[model samples]
Target: MAEPRNCSECNDSLYGQQFILKEELPHCIKCYETLYCDNCIACKQLIGCASKDVLFKNQHWHGKCFLCTRCNQSLVDQPFATRDDLLLCSACYCDEFSAKCHACLRVITPGSKKMEHKGFSWHENCFTCKLCQETIGTRSFVQKEANNYCLICYEKTFALQCFHCMKPIISGGVNYRDQPWHKECFVCSKCKQQLAGRRFTSRDDLAYCFDCFCNLFSKKCAYCTTPINGLGGSKYISFNEVQWHKECFNCKKCCVSLVGRGFLTCNNDIFCPDCGKGI
Candidate 1:
């Protein structure tokens, strides 16, 4: 050989030997690989080709160097998080920054799907209806003091249905005969007049306003020949299947009121005891 070339890395003569050229200087294979390897962001050292490497979030790290700060577990090729330049595994991140779900009491991790309402948060699968156990994620829901409910469950559990419309009565509903009805739905069965906040009567399952109840259902009073309003426990007298107002039960001949005292009826007429003896 005419001249011996000195390797720049080890200062050794490279005479007919395999080597690498780096930056216009000759370097041995071992030195050349070490100098050009990827640098580890975590350890801030060159990661040699023989050493395992981890690439995360557009950064590189040595396998053992990429570890959770809190748990000290290797995060190579695994899910991890970063907080203020501190690496953390999924479990350690949850322990540090997650909240307990109100329903299931499980830790809710950051960057996971969650449901929130009224300042309370839950995991996507943990948020469910109290009565039905149906998941309410991304659906309409009703909450009642620490309880979550779907619309169907909420209506069935809390709201009463109007008897007329057969739908849930959410507010301002009326109760008649142990049945529930909406304020606007409580109407007369015959005339369709509103019965809420007004006088009405019920025969079987049907409701009627005062006028409709009297005209359609009440019996005619014998004396006045008018429909008797016997609703609300109003007083009336009956003789031989004929109905009369309490004030109308009087002697037919003398027109004397015969309420309470002994009375008689003859030929469809009511008479006081004295008026009956005279007749």
Candidate 2:
């Protein structure tokens, strides 16, 4: 068989040009000459082209092209501009109906406008709820602290108070700063000393500064007026302000000058284990 002719446009030898082969083939059917293939343009795959045209600028393209790549829309009777090899139709190129958010100054669609003043448009809720960093929507927005805020933030920011120390939260009160405190924290108020672990609170709901309560009520040993050192002492007494060693306070029950083990206290008086059981 005779060798087929080469494509007039690409000049590549015709081997599988007659069949579908590797790419879509475009040919001058009248002269039986190959013109171009699918790979000639990138946009052709996205929106199919009806007919090809060679322009005076040496660019080849389909005559009836639709869809601008930049804005991803059908380009029907619309003016277009090119930037960075992508075509932007006139609507997207001019930013038609685009407006800046009044609060954030972010460029958003004009349809989102809620209020307008002095050539600026604002989202309605954002205009009222200005306090604290929050995205304000229309329904729950209100004015607070001389600024706008959402309903949830206003409650947490103002109403709640610390139960233990009675200190008002300055920041992050709702989630982080919580109510209620250790008894020791209130007792140590006068001395301003924060107790390590042990705590107590008065039944009256009055906050006692740490110093006055600990000094007045803590039990201690009679002899030393110091707190009982160990947990399981048999002898104990209310010495200065807190519970203390009773044997250290001069073991009165034995009357034999008791030594070694401490005595325990109940109510206001000291009692040895036998005497305490008899009573």
Candidate 3:
């Protein structure tokens, strides 16, 4: 007669009753479940024979307990991701941890091209010029007022135009008379001398250096015979189609002051009324 089977742990008789084989050793159902069944990682409960067991990374979990840490959705046979060792569903993972494009404000998934600038990220196709609407892939760009633009579009849209050359002034330009101009283009119209960072004058909407303007346009003082440029707020006297300095406008014979007083002209010389009789 064959030997009778018995439970290995409890030593219970296993004659004509359901038993479990653990490592080729016969064990009672209660003993096998209590001694050898896997404990669920999620709920810390034992997984029995009638219960569905889920396995991941050598950790066991009950089917109902296997869920995403963030959304609490079941991760059974669905794509999932792990962040900081926490289980997460694909959608929840992207929403919670993925990089968002700065331009389009969309998710920048893994394995896709991305660009980053000033702590902001962008999808490759979405990073484009705001004005031209063209992709700026690994190319030079400008950011102004929270908008991105390519070099060409930035210059055309925001750069100052030189009043003299009529070209775009990208950087380091001069401003004169509320007009913009390139440094090299801001030159005297008469002598072609550079006028930037120097005293200059304008006539008929044209720029001229101080020397050139005084020599060409300033009127000569009748008494002093010197150019009266009216610079430094100096006052001058104008009469009989001639200009004179305030101190030089005097009678020729008596040397009396003639400013705001009646004067007489003798052979292109100014004399007071009393001095005119002697002359």
Candidate 4:
């Protein structure tokens, strides 16, 4: 029988040595690997059939060696990133590049609910009303004094309904008798003039200016037949619902002013000291 053939590259006997047949020529394991094995990018080792190989982005890696550099998680056959030769799994990739949430101060993970406005961000579950502590989610919100609030809590805390206009007063307003009013809404009910910071009177919750009150509600002077303008709150005398200003009061018979002198009323007329004695 003919002698067993030898490996062409290693010169080892092929019948017992580990080798490969290339072009019907027996090549030893050392030479076969140099020609057939691929270099693994992850571990920087030559990969053969015995090694579980993974191909990605025109590069080869040993399956067990492909892992996220930050998390150290295996990324074999999974979505991953390789930037500047650093491998990263999807989650780690997103954490490395995503924006931080303003509420929690953490990275907003991919595929997670997020809310953003005015270049600020927050996780949906982290966004909440500062007053009620309720989750605001994607619904309407209002920012007040550096705090976030939902519409309901914002209204409940800051909405001031004007008693006159029946509308919400958002800024500076007048408050009297425990009722709130817009600056423009706090006006004289009779003249419709703005009365903010002005002296005014209220009746049945209706506000009026001093002049308007005198014109509409004051009593008439018995002599002048014009409004006394003080109603019942001045130096005056009254008899049978008839009133007179101190200066207007006089003895009807002598025509002498009776402001500080003795006087008497007869029927509907007044008499001074000398005039009364004659009567």
Candidate 5:
């Protein structure tokens, strides 16, 4: 009979019977299955193998040994910072290193915070008084001299007077060029909301900014008094200063104008007595 070979792993001599190294043995080594050694290729120490093939990459770590550099708290499964030799985790990084704007809550990147207040930081343009929430857009605030007011706040607070009406805005206003205006005085060049602080004024007595007063007003409906869009049912006529639908005009004989009456309909006509028979 042939003598048995030694076991490759333990290097122990096998007598008479052949030593069979099981397939599971090599798998166990990769997964830190052996109790003697726990080191891994990534230099991390392992506590135990979660699976047959999965080895704990950090052999030095007993279990989840990640720590934040700033706070030194266990990182667990959270994102760890890998910046510039620092092993900080997310929570510690944000608390200790990241800068945030004091007024707007915007994240201030490194080298971006132009001003610092009580340890909080801000962008270069963020520190102006007009940049505050209520002051932004229509009106602007100046420290010494700067164009920082957003736009809206600048207009509301500073505009001088209405171009068309020449009415001064006392509460708040906009200044177009050297002229000032009330918001209601200037018509929107786009939507026609008075462009109180609009830069450009048009030639027509109906001066409008680029934003307000874009669409021209057409003929107005006599009945509804809204601009006409060509849905012709009743002919509209101008009586006195006001326009009225010819069919809707009332006669004194059919409807009596009564005081404090909500509505009166007669002879297919509606009348308000205070306005009289021609109404």
Candidate 6:
């Protein structure tokens, strides 16, 4: 017959009885629990043969003690996360540590898509245009104040319209007469020449080049038959529904200046007082 076995710790008889092998040594159930059972990492209680044992990273815990430290929910056979040596279920881990979406102010769970802008974060679905209420995925976007906008929505809502073409002026525009204009659209009304970075004038709300303005609108001198430029505060003489340059306002017979003094007009000709007596 085989030799009768005995408990390793207490030397008790193990004949025809159940026993536990620890380090290849046979022990009774009571001795095995007292001498070789693992203590629970969570509850600090021994995990005996009668109780289910859970082991993680070489640490042991009773089945009842193997739960999320935060929510106290069972982590057995479930996804879990560890933070600062504390066990947590996936839900509790996400709630306690995941980043929050900037738009909806809700937690953004791990393994989900997210968007980051500036210094804030958002869930993929929550990152949407403020005006159109549509998702703005990987496409281009714009941010205004505290709102996000799709490129189309941003242009429609905020871009200025060109004064001439009436189209959206996305960039590099001119502000004239309290109206916005595209650089290419701000041209002389009469000649169609580009007036940006060049001298131009407005007449009756129409923009014109200097030459066009002088020929189309400036007063003509009576004697010289030339346009009398009045831009930049230049002085000119006006009388009898006609205008003249100060140098051109001289007597026709004696060639003496008739400016700021008594003068006579004979058949659209100007004469000084002394020359007019003889004329």
Those runs of model 3 whose alpha carbons end farther than 4 Å from true positions after fitting are 1-4, 15-18, 160-279
A best-first ranking of the candidates according to their TM-score comes to 6, 3, 4, 1, 2, 5
Regions of candidate 5 where Cα sits further than 4 Å from its true position: 1-8, 11-23, 26-64, 104-132, 135-148, 155-279
lDDT of each: 0.83, 0.49, 0.88, 0.81, 0.50, 0.88
Q: Which residue window of length 10 is worst by lDDT in model 6?
A: 1-10
lDDT tens per residue, model 4, 22-79: 8977787778878878899867899876678888878888888877899889897688
Give the runs in model 2 whose Cα sits over 4 Å from its true position.
Answer: 1-72, 75-107, 110-126, 129-189, 192-206, 209-212, 222-279
What are the TM-scores, per candidate, against the unseen true structure?
0.45, 0.31, 0.54, 0.47, 0.31, 0.55
Output the TM-score of candidate 4: 0.47
Put down candidate 3 lDDT per residue, 33-96, tens digits, no spaces.
8987899998898999778899888999899998999889999999999988899999899889
Superior candidate under TM-score, 4 versus 6 = 6
Give the RMSD in angstroms, all C-alphas superposed, for model 1: 15.8
Clashing pairs in 4: none
lDDT of 2: 0.49
- The stretch of ten residues in a row with the least summed lDDT in candidate 5 is 51-60
lDDT of 6 by residue, 1-279 (tens): 454489888999998888977787888999888877899988898899999999999999999889999889889999999999999999999889999999788999998999999989999989999988899999888788979988798888998889788988766799999999998999999989989898998988899999899988889988998888877777889898988888899999988888888999987798888888966
| lDDT value, residue 177 of candidate 3 | 91
* Candidate 4: count of backbone clashes, pairs at least 3 residues apart or interchain: 0
lDDT of 3 at 245: 91
lDDT of 5 by residue, 69-162 (tens): 6777765566666567566776666556677766677666554536654455667666656445442322334332334444455545664556
- Residue lDDT tens for model 1, 1-279: 244387787888777876767777787666776777679897788887668978777788888898899989988778988889899899988888888788778889777888888888899889999988888889888788889889888897887678778998766888888888888887898988778889877788788888988888779999898888866678998878998998888889888988777888887798888879957
TM-score of 6: 0.55
Evaluate model 3: give its TM-score.
0.54
Model 2 lDDT, residue 274, Cα: 57
